[model samples]
Target: MNARPLPSLNILTGTEVQERLIQARALQAAFKKEWKRLVETIAKTETPFQSIGTHEYAEELAVREVEQETKAIEGKAQRLEEITNGSIASLKKDRQRVGFMRSKSSVLTVGSNLSKDAGLMASLGVWADDFEALWSVQKARAASEALQEQLDKTKEKFKQVGKKYREIKFKNQLLSANIKLVENQCKELEKYRAHETRCKSKTERLEKSKALL
Candidate 1:
């Protein structure tokens, strides 16, 4: 059985979208202006001499006409909204498809490369004709890797120590401030105690003198 080919989808470009948007905006502006003009010409704030061949008043007729115009424009605006949204959604889907294709290609390429390199990695020591030279290179690479690991560990340890030091320094500062506050309070208390003692001694001498008299 023969299958029919699918119909091609038409996509709007950026310019077409912009043009449609401008057209929709122009219609909206015209709708508003037309409504305003009808209000000024046919509809009046006061009761009219004539109702213009209808039982409704002049203002009521104007409102009906404006409502009719609004319905038409509302349909157009809705269609324009649909077109804009559909175009944006289509573009997003196309972008996602392209990204998926690229990732798939990358995965396939990596798989092919890994298959090719698997044998070479297994026979790493025999890759070079000179066994001694290859061994020296491998040794150097191992040493470099070891050094890099050590450096990373040292950096992590230093970071931990530095954070701990900062915490301790902050606590020390708080304790120093507390000690200074307590020292000031102690000095104030000493002054108040000396004053109380002097007042008590004077009162005692005056009482003794008054009792003798």
Candidate 2:
């Protein structure tokens, strides 16, 4: 995008430079709005596997969207910084040209010449603002990534707790089965004890009847 050379500051008057500064400030405002929205989106984003056994795809999609958005913002910040640097360099070069002219020229006109230098200074100020705006966005993205890392850790803990819950549930089921089996065996042992009592009573009765005879 920056392959073409920018027009030198010599041709641009103070009024025209002021116009450019306005545009630059407006661009910075837009960046601020975008940064605010990005922070909001990061805050609203949900993590993958946050829910138990559901919404996996939806959560994953949300995470990917956040990642892509962050990457795009980061790209914009880098590009803006590069452009701002180029603009500052151009301004400096123009100032040098003006200074060299002032040294050789005897007239040393102040009105137009001073306005031109003031305009260049103003231009530099706006570019600095642009640089600052980009820096803020980068910082915000860093903070968002940190928050995401914490969320991931929380999600991992949730998964671990879920696994432990399933393990406990399985153990409880095994304990219930064992208890039922023991109850059934106790019923069978009770039946055998009753049969032994009946046999002892029959043997005693037979012995008494024989004595009577």
Candidate 3:
């Protein structure tokens, strides 16, 4: 059966991100514990097939059990990797947008200041010889007021972007932590699978020897 599509990270709010991170961490912890238990169980299981009848069956069953568990863990690791990658990509895009907005706000502030200075110059008759001083002052004041309004709006937008950037950064850190945990779990599972392979090979050898006898 086809799996349900994963949710896009870009649409997640801060709370949603936190919730997902928590769930991922809990799953990671549970998987790690289960994996360790499996390894210990496998290690403690006797391998010599002392009772030729039941021991062979038991060995076969244990191998099959471990193989199933390994497959499950591998599947979980793949899903976690996909989630982590999506989160990282979404956060990177948000950071870039915020950075751009901040830069644009700064430019707007500078422009506002220049407009204000022009208004002051016009009021002082700086261009009176070429233009009507009153009209120059009125025009400059209108431009200054418009620029100031735009600057105010830009500043507000900048504040919003800053807030969002901080939130995204925090979520990114949580995702990074989750990714690390999942990666470590995957590595441990890999080691267990390798050990399981050796056990399977040894079991096969023993079976062959028994057949020859």
RMSD, candidate 2, Å? 33.4
**For residues 122-191, what per-residue lDDT tens digits would candidate 1 score against the true structure?**
3442333234443444554555555455445544543453354355445545655654554554555556
- All predictions: root-mean-square deviation over Cα? 43.1, 33.4, 31.4
TM-score of every model?
Answer: 0.37, 0.45, 0.31
| Candidate 3 local distance difference test against the native | 0.51
User: For residues 1-213, could you state the per-residue lDDT of candidate 3 as single tens digits?
Assistant: 222333333234445545665787776565545444443444454321122122215334444544454455456555545555554555455556556655655565455778767655644442343234334444545555554554455445434533543554465457568767655555555565566677677777877888899
Model 2, 1-213: lDDT tens digits are 112222232233445545554655555455445444433443454533222222224345445544555565566656656665665566566666656655645454557877777766865765666566556556655665665565566556445544544554455455455545544445554555566577667767777777788
How does each model score on lDDT? 0.49, 0.52, 0.51
Poorly placed runs, candidate 3 (over 4 Å): 1-132, 199-213
Off by over 4 Å in 1: 1-129
In Å, residue 174's CA in model 3 sits off its true spot by 2.8
What TM value does model 1 have? Answer: 0.37
Candidate 2 collision pairs = none
The candidate that wins on TM-score is 2
